[model samples]
Target: MLRTQIIKLTRAPIRSFSAAAVRTAEGDTGGVRSGGVASSDSFNKREAASENKFIREREMETLRQLKEKLRAQRKHLDELDAHISDLESTKGGEQN
Candidate 1:
């Protein structure tokens, strides 16, 4: 088999260092050098913040549920106390 192939190469546009720096400072680096590299710290911070928010929301929900459970238990204890007091009063009258 005898075949010839033609390939074309394209050059990326060039930008001055000062211009690139300005873009980087403004946080608009388009994700690499030819465009702009995204800052790793900023990306990581964003991810951490999102994870923290999820954790906080879950914890808050759990706390709310626990508080509700505590309130119900307190109410039940108060009712039990009232019933015991009534029973004690009746027994005292019967004894007298």
Candidate 2:
């Protein structure tokens, strides 16, 4: 009964593997036993959480770098526009 409950709590892939690997012994209530599968499950949860944190940090760093590059490109374009305006004014004055 305890094993059945645990199997239900686990995700499908882990459930399948754990159901096959878990060994049970009869308890006084016929529903309880002692083991460390729960500990193993906790470890897996922690590892997955750590991996997700790492992925999120990497994604945020990439986004920040892209934003900096975009800002630099905009600055360069603005400079070019100012230069073009100056050249156009000089040419108009010369033609007069």
- Give me the candidate number with maximum lDDT: 2
State model 1's lDDT: 0.78
**For residues 1-96, what per-residue lDDT tens digits would candidate 2 score against the true structure?**
999899888846533635466566663223323566686567668988999999999999999999999999999999999999999999999999
TM-score, prediction 2: 0.58
Candidate lDDT values, in order: 0.78, 0.82
Task: Write out the backbone clash pairs for model 2.
Answer: none
lDDT at 84 for candidate 1?
99
**Candidate 1 — worst ten consecutive residues by lDDT sum?**
1-10
TM-score of 1: 0.60
lDDT of 1 by residue, 1-96 (tens): 123222222445677767444335664535543423366666768988999999999999999999999999999999999999999999999999
Q: For model 1, what is the error of residue 32's alpha carbon versus the real structure, in angstroms, after optimal superposition? A: 11
Identify the leading candidate in terms of TM-score. 1
